[model samples]
Target: MSDASPAPVTAAILVIGDEILSGRTKDKNIGYIAEYLTNSGIDLREVRVVPDVAEEIVAAVNALRTRYTYLFTTGGIGPTHDDITADCVAQAVGVGIDVDPRARAMLLERIKPEDLNEARLRMARIPFGAELIENPISKAPGFMIENVIVMAGVPSIMQAMMDSVAPRLKTGARVTAETIEAGNLPEGGYAEGLAVIAKAHPGVSIGSYPSMTPAGFRNQIVVRGREPEALAAARTEIEALLARLQAERT
Candidate 1:
């Protein structure tokens, strides 16, 4: 292993909505955030799904923002009556929410002055000193306050915001992953040997995924490492172990 320090980046995703908790709507932000963070070389350490309760939202936002290097929140910031993410986040960060001049100008560019009613005006309310995150699909913008970045709940808007914001975030050395598929092997049968192999390589992470096949069952073992040399060495050992185990079974 290299003596270099590990990347200094961590992130967390907060999915907020009563609909998701009630199973009326499936949450999609977690997967998107996880993949995006991984690709950006930020370790996604935690994910939380909370109902649209003011106290819960405030608590979660406070806790996550303080703990992680970056906190991304989705949902509960719309124009509807239930939308309280902005207010909660404002309270969490000890900032006052007001109609931001930049946000109002951005919204006014797309929507007519007559259409800008109280409900629509709510969209312009953001925490003090927050920077706007561009939304290409819709005129409504997301905001970044301190370490926390808030975005839309809709998948398309979230993705667009991520595309715009990714280049600005700090990145670290990316972790590399490799996989080996062992056809028709039972996980229970190979668990002992796999454990031995795992023990031998402390720096590599190995996981076994079992699946059903037309012939019988299959097992896939994935090995991941940050260093190429360590990763290749670990894969060689894992392949040899798998070959020996297969030979024994046959």
Candidate 2:
């Protein structure tokens, strides 16, 4: 028999900002990134929220980039005192960060010379050999190094950068998911039967998501697989099992 390949392409997201940790800002990028990656066949394995400290940012960037197929970082790239993601990333990779000419040219086109002072110049610094990720909402560009994609903290700019980067990412075979709802059925009641069904379809993954209510508990069984045929077959088997379980309950 041939060897089994990896199940899914995986990615990690790092959200860097003092505002997030301080509760001054609620993070909205992780959900957006997770959804975007999942739809493109990239499994989101991990998410991290770190403060604007350089050491923390560097450590997170180093670890995630090494462990995941792709790493996406949002926030900490602005012109403020806390904007340190670029420098931290450079330190993480042992590369010197400097003002990028391409980024400067782009910035110059949009920002006046007087506006390109120290505060604004902070936005142009990029890790050596990194490519720019376009930000349509603002002139400041994000940069990508190896598999790490750095993006703006602002939602609109982050979305635009994602649009620019999504097409170029490598994707494995897409995983298809099917769900069946068992209304008002306690998950424990069907656990054994579901186990049998899961054993029979070992290639497909089955999960029981349960929610509690004032009346009782309900469950939603989700089956996921790379092969559509396998997923469909597993779904049918699960539905049959659910039907049998329901009859037994009533």
lDDT of 1 by residue, 1-250 (tens): 7987775599999999999999998888889889888877798999999999999999999999999899999998788889999999999999899998888888888889999998988888999988899887777889988888899999989999998788778888777888898777778777888798788887788899988768777789999767788889878987887788789978
Predictions: Cα RMSD each: 1.8, 2.2
Counted clashes in each candidate structure: 0, 0
Q: Tell me how far the alpha carbon of residue 138 in candidate 2 is from the true structure, in angstroms, after superposition.
A: 0.5
1-250 per-residue lDDT for model 2 (tens digits)? 8688765789999999889999999888889988888789898899999998888899999999999899999998998888999999989988899889889887898899887998888999999989899877777999999889999988989999999988889988777788899887788788898898889888898999988878777789999888787888888988888898789878
Question: TM-score of each candidate?
Answer: 0.94, 0.92
> What lDDT does model 2 reach?
0.89
Task: Candidate 1: list runs displaced more than 4 Å.
Answer: none
Winning model by lDDT: 2
Instruction: Kindly give the stretch of ten consecutive residues in candidate 2 with the minimal lDDT sum.
Output: 1-10
